[model samples]
Target: MLTPQWLDALRARITLSAVVGRSVRLQKAGREFRACCPFHDEKSPSFYINDAKGFYHCFGCQAHGDAIRWLTDHQGLAFMDAVKELAAEAGMELPAPDPRAAKSAERRASLSDVTEAAQRWFEDNLSAPIGTNAREYLAKRGISDASARAFGFGFAPDQRQTLKAALPFDEALLAEAGMRIAPEDGGEPYDRFRGRLMLPIHDARGRVIAFGGRTLAKDAGGAKYLNSPDTPLFDKGRTLYNLHRAAPAARKAGRIVVVEGYMDVIALAQAGLAEAVAPMGTALTEHQLELLWRQADCPILCFDGDAAGQRAAMKAIERALPILKPGLSLGIVRLPAGLDPDDLVRERGAAALEALLSRPQPLAEALWEFERDAGPISTPEAKAGLKARLLDHVGTIGHPDIRALYRRELLERFSALAFPPRYARVFGREARRGEQARTSAPAVIDRLQQLAKGGARDGFGLAVLSGLARHPGEISRHEEALIHLARAEPALGPAIDALLALSETLDSPAPSPISGAIGLPALPDRNLYAFLIEGNSPDLVREDLAEAVSLLVEKPALKAAKAAATARFDRDPEGSMAEQGRLRAREMALDERIKRLGRKRAASPRDDSSRSPSPGAMTAQATD
Candidate 1:
């Protein structure tokens, strides 16, 4: 655990001014500095940085936090990890981890060691006989040896345990890194990537977290390309290959060229078009999209002109619509027919690929492809169906003005299609329906508020009710939202109770049970709850014994009840059947309640009391 003095020192070291100045142009506003918020799309500056307070607050998005919090949220670092990063930036050494944190740190270190070992083994093999074919194949593909080493290309030997002999890492650790197989018969570990070309996957911070391997042989058994499974350090869905090296170049070019494979990214970079990344075989996920969005203003998705590639590009566009805004754009760079990015760069030279990237189609042009490819709308029914699909796509756009313009464009396009005048009415009707849907959402919010104030039987339920009542329209019925809230406020049992009541009252079924809802409290109530439960609880509660005690004991004051039961059981030794039964019931009830409370405490998070009121809070107070 970080001491208060250490936290204060760390806060003083990396102020909000430093963070904002690096990303945004700031103007002095009395004691605070103001700039356009980096967290969202904004024209006028609404982000305020208070250097004296070591925090930042954006009036536009209601994003307010200290330096560490800002780094964690904006840069996507884990809380303690963010703290350490900031501390390192500030030239401060981190204190030794406590027992619990020590174990976690050790596990992370083990994973890191495994990855580093695998990376070194691959690097060594790249020059050896085992990697000769892979190296020659790269040369044939026009990848220079210098470029190959720069991007850390290597080859995994066909033989098993090739890496095991080279590194001091244990088999279990290698298996965790997605490098070796865990044996059932206590046999020696075997390589996971046999007879494949290796491309080391690095995090945004440039640490080798995992690897992506491609089959050398056309008839290779398993997958054509294999990516590392989710481990302690790498999540394939959240990672973009070559992002670490490409980020600076992408930012400089004001665009990121997203390709489909490891070779596409490497070949582009080698060809001197450095701003390129590839999805790890999966469709462009929202997580990957957000990562790219953070690096540059616009991201150009360059895929092959083949049917599969077009389908992938469209999927990417659909995934990005909600996230992409005015300054942030998504354009498509269509390669020549039947040619992938790697093939184009290899044959036509890097200049041709770079020219295509430089002259990407506008977002509207790419979005229009969705309609163009769907076939013509000659009849009224066809036009109506088209308009509905277009409207759904427009609705997904986050910007209202952008959505409205697209709606108008859809109407204009339909008019051009020579559809009857009645077809234009379909666009108007769909726009009205979208408006109505937004208006109807408040009704759900109002219902949740009513449930919260109704004082449900469960105290935990009432607490949850109170929270939902506080943010009526903002909350969602999705399990993710609940889980997010639970993580923000560990002591959200009461709030969750209210949510449960709201769910029940609305005749909606509760979804799957999420145990860690209270893990990292996001709300003020949740944060308070976590502080109380984790920081203030006795050793029993801290040890997760509270749940067992709650189930065994009865009533609200579980500690007192447990004490009474224990005394009765001790005095009688061979107690009466009725007395023993009563004692057992009390004990069980207490255990259940403790568990419930523990879960609740984990869900609700408290706001940092050390910081002053944010701009929004001050304005709210003034209004009140």
Candidate 2:
């Protein structure tokens, strides 16, 4: 559990606008802002923002939430993790977690300790007698002694008990680190990567999370390359080897060079090309792509020029096309035949590899590779097939303008083949529709209302309501009318109470005089008085009282009325008369009208029975 102070600090750090702005193109609309929903493919913008309330709602998908909820759901972070991320973004330090959360923190710390211990043990073993063959193999591969130490290169002895006796660790702990192999005979555990040159894999934060090892001998009996098993600290799909070292170089170079193996990264770094990373014997995942995107505008994937490497590059391109923004690029660096990055660096030297990096193939050239090997487009059938394939590739590209330009280029390329005009028209229409959907305002408002009504029941509801309070301008008058209904009925009482509680938690001293900020609208004073007059359920009445108190605390006019009411209650403590009697009489008349409305509701054919009394009637009766 996060402490109140921590939660407050997180709130101050993150806002809905900042979260939405990163992925979507947001434009100001009145007091709020609007953008297309990134969670779903939308052409028209159905996502809305109320900066004042710090809330966002998507009309199309019915997604609604505050900043924290948005980050948790959109970015796939845990709730507290989202809080911490926002807190960090705001440059604020969070307080210690609650007592219950301390146990989780302790467990995490222990895992870190275990990982650090394993890394140290591996580093120490690099120069041990058992690592002689590994050292010889590295020397043969042109890896210097200094480079080996710099990368924590090491060896796992073939003996089963060597690792067990080397550290005060159990088999379970080794297994947890993905470094132990279980015996068939229930014997002692053995090393997972024997007779191999080890490469410690660290995460983005430079923690030794996992390992990758290369076979030093031809008859090592194990696979050529073995990676650490999936553990709490490592997910092969998500972790790129050498990202810790490559990130700064990638940022400095304004491009990342992705390779295929531990040696590829090590060899590149040794060759003075340090901005290279590779997956741990797996295809690139979106998580890894996001990490790369954060570091640079363009990433050059350097794969071997073999068929398998080409296929892998195509797959990576497909995975990235949808998420790649306008300025962001994905270029391919196809190495010479029968050569990986390491072999290329060793054979041709760093200057040759640097030349290859300089002449990267653009994203369009990679996409064109699909058409290069296809059948001739002179025939009608071939033309149709080519057009269809081209449209499919173009459609996968996320940006509308880019997709259209590619489509035009495809048509020009196939002009001699004589493809149907309908194909081009259809693709163009789809791109147009996507653009239209991203800019529409009414669609955003409709989605916001739908989200506000239905989304309030989920775990993210309070956050959504808080966002609404922060950004009321994104919400339309019609939507507000619907929200107003929540205050009049018992079914909506809990939701109202939840919103009020969330608001109370947000109240703090204004941070250094707000600049050009719109505040949330004042809650209706008459609504509160009406709820108190009517004999509603206790829960409903209590919520009404709370909401009234909150509003009065903020509004000067309402505060004075509240003081007068309190004075009347205090002055007529014994008499049970005075302004209280007048208020009760007004309450009785309002109750009669409510009963009449109830009878009318029972006779009406409408489905909704939660309508409130007419405002004019309530106001008239209050005056009487």
Candidate 3:
């Protein structure tokens, strides 16, 4: 665990702008640097980096945090991954891991030793007299000795048990390193690879953790390429080859390209495209995609033009969709049929490969192309199928704004392609209904606000609405509770709906349209809502409003529990009594929380209003 002091020291050492500016284009904006928010879609810049404060905040998406948070959220790094990356950048050693983690760390260190020792063993075999065929294979592939050694290329001898004898490890250790196979009988373990060219797979820190081997022997029944199975230290699905080398170049180039195999990555590097990486033999996993996203927003995926390559690209697209965020997506490059990245570079030169990469297709466009060609769309059934496929892909995107836009773009193409204008006109009324719902949303909100003044329950419900209105940004934090409340009290449903709608557009600190929810009828005494809407310190009011909403949610939950406990009184007397006691204790705790919050409010200078919201405001609701 990183203590607060260590985190603070790390943050203080690393310039927030420097870290953020690598990925986002920042412009000077008075004291803070600004960029269009990476977390959401926006025309103008609303993401700000404050070097003075050592943090960044996206006013557009309400994504606010320090450097570590940026790494986790923006880079999709695991918490520890973010911390270690930052610590390394700041030149700080992490605090020692606790006992259990220390054990795991020691185990990994041992596994790494075995892999590294095996790497040396393979390199030795490469230059030995027996490695003549492997050297020939590299030469045939146009790989120079310099490039081969730079990538730590090696050869595994054809004889079995060769690695087992050379490496300083027992059979069990060798098997654990994925370097040896255990025989089914009560027999010895043998080397997994024979007559294969070897590539060392390194972790982000450039430590060898696994190996990928390709056949040097022709058409032997074995697979073309074999990777180390997942071991204590290596997971092919989570690992990317050449990342340790490509990351620095990727940061400089502001781009990263992902290819199908490690050979493709090495070929690109050899051809002067140093920013390419590839997943181990498996298709790109979410973990590997996150690794790619950390280096570039739109890494170009260069796949072969064959059926398998198209299938791989689509598979990657499906994997990427749900994790796609604004400003974070993929670009795709399809090599000509019967060609891969290596083939293209070899035949046409690096310039041709670069030219192909330059005009790569956007993921959305690729999606359209793939589905449009899935089948004939001349018939209505085929057209509907096309639309369904497009929507299915779009639905997988998790970000709200990005998802909406992808849907809009793809549906527009679908409408044009599948329906054309004549057929579109036939379904004009259906389309019109969608437009009407959108156009009428504001009127619905206005109507509901008017009705919010109709009854006592609504009056109280409107108080919750008003609180949310004053702190539009807090709507996201309390959205789940507000949604739950909507189900319980139908009177506040429309107001809750309006609050949510407004939250989506509350990208700026500009006056919220939903704040007009503060328009209240005259009451006998100024309640919490009245004071907060017109508070002197907007910050203070937002705090009080959050507490109020928490109470609003807790009240309904407590009532539901009480109802259940009372229902059980007849049959399960002792259980009901005990449950009732526990519920009462919880109610007392809730009362205390409200009192503490109210006291905090009371200590603050009051806004120019008739009264302040009571600290015990939740007590009345708890009993009722």
Candidate 4:
């Protein structure tokens, strides 16, 4: 894990607008940088990056966070990978690994050297006198020398001592690199790649880390394809084949095509589809999916059109659904029933495979297509099972918006298909339509009315939210403060989320005073909200909401602290007394902070107040 101090330094050292702008094509928009929202397909620009705040938010998708999150979410990098990448860009060395991890890290470097050396040796053999068989095989497959070199294709000679004579490393180190297989009894280790065609597998940085070998000779072995054993440097489950090369192409092409094997990726590349990548002779792994995502939010999975390929696609889908987010997803393409990428490209041409990729089904549709027709739906029990399975898959999604959308869409489809409506004149259409209208209308209205009361049984912490909804513009400015408040006051979670969603949708250019048109999740205390925003100037609302958010954040925080201190009183009186003293001081200081903001409101522009919490600066209540 990256240290907080290092994270802070990284954030501070880089200008977010510049970093995001390089990829997003941002143009200066007022105080922030703006881009046409990349997370969602939109015409007008709604994405903004606030370098001062060290965060970017997509008003379209509600994607908000700092640099680390951008890398993890938008770029599809793992947390540590993102950190290391950002650190490198900032010219900062990562903090030292734990002592226990240091040796593994050091050993991995030695293994990488072995893989690199072996890669060269294999490449040399592909062109050497002993490589005639390999050369002939490539020629027969229509692979040019340039193409083979581009993919780092190589060959392992039939003789076992070829590596023994060529590699400088000893048997022990070679075994660690997955280059040699040691005998169970006390025998010398033998070459692992004898009589095979070799393809070097690279990490995201394009460093050779592993090898995938296809047997060349007759009666050659245990499996058709074998990958390097999972060693310290190579874990097939965590690495994608050709990612180091395909990532840039994926970014430019706006999608990655994930095939089933290294040769498929090579064939696609040969056919001018440079964006294709593959798994290392196994099912696609979660990490590989993430790697694809780093290049494009929605990657295309091109599976061979066979029962095995369908199973592989399903496995990848099941592994990926849990991490599905609002703006990131997958697309699927099943090749013609019995052919793979290489076969398709070879038989018809690049255009034929390109045509298949051009028409990709959404993951939801793919999931529905697979599960819906798996068994008969004529029986209600089977239909119910389909619905249950769909719900289960949707439930795994982590993002609230995507989860909700998937559920709604899937359920609606199930309801229509499992229990289709009757003719309009008969009764079903009119009756069901009326029922749905009544069911939905009262639901949202009654909930809002109850929330506005702050008195009914269904009260939803409405007071803080009504004021927030009336001044959604303030939500972004006070997000951190609100996040802290949300933690201390769980009851306000729904309201906070609603306000955030509404605020993100609000337009820039300094919003007008709250109107009835401001969509809110729940109604506020009507009289208070009306008095606060009706005919109020944008500046006045900013001042008022500034104070409101301050109070909302501080009051709840202080109250929680007091309650906590009181609880600890029975156990640790002295500590509780000290805590109580600190809370009281913070409470008073919070009052002072509010007073200072009030004074600043009268004297300065709205920008001064709207600038999000400055570096190392916090409201007194937050300090507590």
lDDT of 4 by residue, 1-624 (tens): 666787899999878887676567988888998888766678898889999999999887797888877766665556887787788888988889898898888888888889999999999988889889988988888888889989888999877777978999988899999999998997877899888889999876578999998887767657778889999888988888888777656755678889998788888888899888888777877777767777887899898899899989988898888888777889999888999999999999999989988999999889888888778888878887998999889878887557655765576567557644332444433322334322333333344444555553322235445555545445566665566766876656655655555444433333323333333333333323221324445566665665556565657668888989989998999999999999999889876765554454445433542333232231111000
> Per TM-score, what order, best first?
3, 4, 1, 2
TM-score of each: 0.56, 0.52, 0.60, 0.59
In candidate 3, what residue range of length 10 has the lowest lDDT sum? 615-624
Best by lDDT: 3
2 or 4: which has the higher TM-score?
A: 4
Give the per-residue Cα lDDT of candidate 2 at 534.
Answer: 25
Residues 1-624, model 2: lDDT tens digits: 467776765666567687778756898989989987765567888889997877888898787888887655554344666676687788876676687777766755666666677678777777878667878888988999889888888777666666667767667877777778887899867877676677888876567888887777776676888888898778888888887677656644557899988888889999998888898787788878887776566788998888888888888887887777778878888888799989988888999999999999887777666564545766678867876887788789888546645655565455423522112146445222223322332233334345445643432222233233332221221132224444443344454443333222221212211111122112222122323122343344333333333232223332344457667666576443555565565556544643443343235343322234333222110000
Clashing pairs in 3: 598-615
Worst 10 residues of 4 by lDDT: 615-624
Report the alpha-carbon TM-score of model 3 versus the true structure.
Answer: 0.60
* Top-down lDDT ranking: 3, 4, 1, 2
Residue pairs whose backbone atoms clash in candidate 4: 75-294
Whole-model lDDT per candidate: 0.66, 0.62, 0.76, 0.72
What RMSD does model 3 have?
13.8
